[model samples]
Target: MRINQFISHNTSHSRREADELIKQGLVKINAKIAQFSDRVKQEDRVFIKDKRIHKKTQFSVIVYHKQKGELVSHKDDRGRKTIYENLPKKFSSWLSIGRLDFASEGLILLTDSALIASALMKSDLEREYYLKIKGHINKEVVEAMENGLEIKNEKKGAHSKSKISSMMIAPFLEYEIFGSSGGYTKLRVVINEGQNRELRRFFGHFDLKIMDLKRVAFGIVELDMLRAGKYRYLEKTEYEKLRDFLRINAIKF
Candidate 1:
């Protein structure tokens, strides 16, 4: 594998972070400063900051059913409850794959293997969510959403010229209206890309307020009957299924 990939797979750093470390001359291969294009052999020795790197063997993957009002992060300045607090003490070293916002609740994956987390996040794996929205559910609204909508980029600075962009919603891939009742609509949404609050922003264009959002599935893993504020170690079959889904041959860590 490439040096960056090797570093990222063997260490806690992500691929991007590994590139930064190489650029800073902190990484070495077989006692020589490594280049970005360098490849690793099974027998090759890798070091970071002059310390020999040893691959971690015991890796844990957890599927957490996050509850609303809990932060995905480990700490909060305001002393709000966080998902980490709900986890066992042994999982303090694990990292969440992505984040669920303070108000959002659902399946969030946590893993001790950074390589697995990074690979899954970078892949085109689908994340399924069940959204409860306050709106008059109609064919028009569903069609509009399926056809895509222009939503302002929340991250763009005030002075940015192009603030609006089309949020692509593939009818067969990203959206499907499952049920609706009494001005409350439930929809199943599948998104491959991890856009920042894309669902909330998408509905905002139609003035449809999301009353509740729950992620029911991610990639090959389903929330199933996993209770809120609870977590369970991923089964061996589940872990292998995820690896197969990502088309990853092996996990070094």
Candidate 2:
């Protein structure tokens, strides 16, 4: 494994943060300052700030049926409810694979392994959502979904403090119209990205207001019958699938 990945997998630091630590000369391999290109073997010793790191060989993951009105955070200055408040004490320190906005309800994956969380968060796996929008699906929407869309002004559905002004949307993997009438449209859509407010921004660009949005799946994991605000460990098959992914990607825990 690369030095940064080794640190990320064995410690609380992210890969990027580990890189920063390396740049600052705080990371060492066998008592020598490590380089970015350095790879670790099983016999190698890795240390951070002079403290040797023990390789972690095991990880845990869980799925949470996140409900609306809960923040995906550990704490908030304004005292809003966070997912940690609802999770068991043992899972409070786990990191989310991605995020569900405060108003969005969905299946969210959390993991005790930073490497696993980073891998899933950055992968081009499919995300499936069920959405209800306050407008009929139009030709423009269909074209954009099929061919992808690029916009220079992409702040419509972004956080007020967000500095992103442009976006490049990739084409949807698949979409199915469930119903369209009564001044609302319901549909299921799949995309292979977790871009910032992607679905919201896409619909918002067309002046279509999303009344409801719920994620039902990510990659090969399905929400199934999980109740809102509840959580469960990944099924055995799901873990097998994840192991395959990690192996294919050359990721080791």
Candidate 3:
């Protein structure tokens, strides 16, 4: 890994902070000052201010059942509840695979390794959800789900501060409608990629409001019997599957 990444992952410093420290001549590799372009192997010894840095090689993953109303962040300036606040203190430094918006909740994966998180987040893994929305899911929505949709300069469902003006929503991997009742419709949907406020934007274009959204599965990891606000370590089988996936995808560390 690059020296900055090494410091950031093994220490509390961010990459930018690591860069600043390197510039200050505090970071060392094998008793020599590390350059900005330096890379280290497993045998290399890295230190910051003479304190040895230990990079954990053993992989660890946690599966958390994210409850609604909790932000998927470390600390929110708005003082809203954050996932880290509820997670075990040991996992405070772990990285979430992706994000579940504050209003949406369900399965979440956290890992201690940034490389693993980055690989899974960018992969075209399936994300499945059950959702309820205002009004019936009409033919147009079904067609769009199957054939994909294109929006230009329409930011209806996106976050207010989002700078995205144009987005191309890919076709859904699968979708199941359970019919509408009492001004609401329930459906199960699947998509491979996580776009910015994707489903919300898609339905918002049709003037429909999503009343509830919950993810049930991500890739091979399922929410299963885990209750809201509960969490568990990934099963051995689950970890093996994840390892096989990364290996098959030829993801390099």
TM-score of each: 0.75, 0.85, 0.92
Q: What is the lDDT of candidate 1?
A: 0.78
Q: What digit string (tens of lDDT, one per residue) describes model 3 on residues 49-128?
A: 98999986568889899998999898999999999999889888888998988899899999878778888899999999
**Model 3 lowest lDDT segment of ten:** 7-16
Full ranking by lDDT: 2, 3, 1
lDDT of 3: 0.89
Query: Candidate 1's residue-wise lDDT over 34-110, tens digit each?
Result: 99999988899999999998866556688999999999887899899998898888776567888778889999999
**Which of candidates 2 and 3 is the stronger one according to TM-score?**
3
Over 4 Å off, model 2: 1-8, 11-43, 46-52
| Top model number, lDDT | 2
User: Taking the tens digit of each residue's C-alpha lDDT, what string does model 2 give over 1-253?
Assistant: 8999788778777677899999999988997899999999989999898999998888889999999999898888989999999999888668899999888999999998877888899999999999999999989999999999997866887777889888999999999988878999999999999998899888888988888989999999999999999999998999999999999999766
- Best first by TM-score, ranked: 3, 2, 1
Q: How close is candidate 3 to the true structure, as a TM-score?
A: 0.92
Model 3 segments more than 4 A misplaced: 11-17, 41-44, 52-55
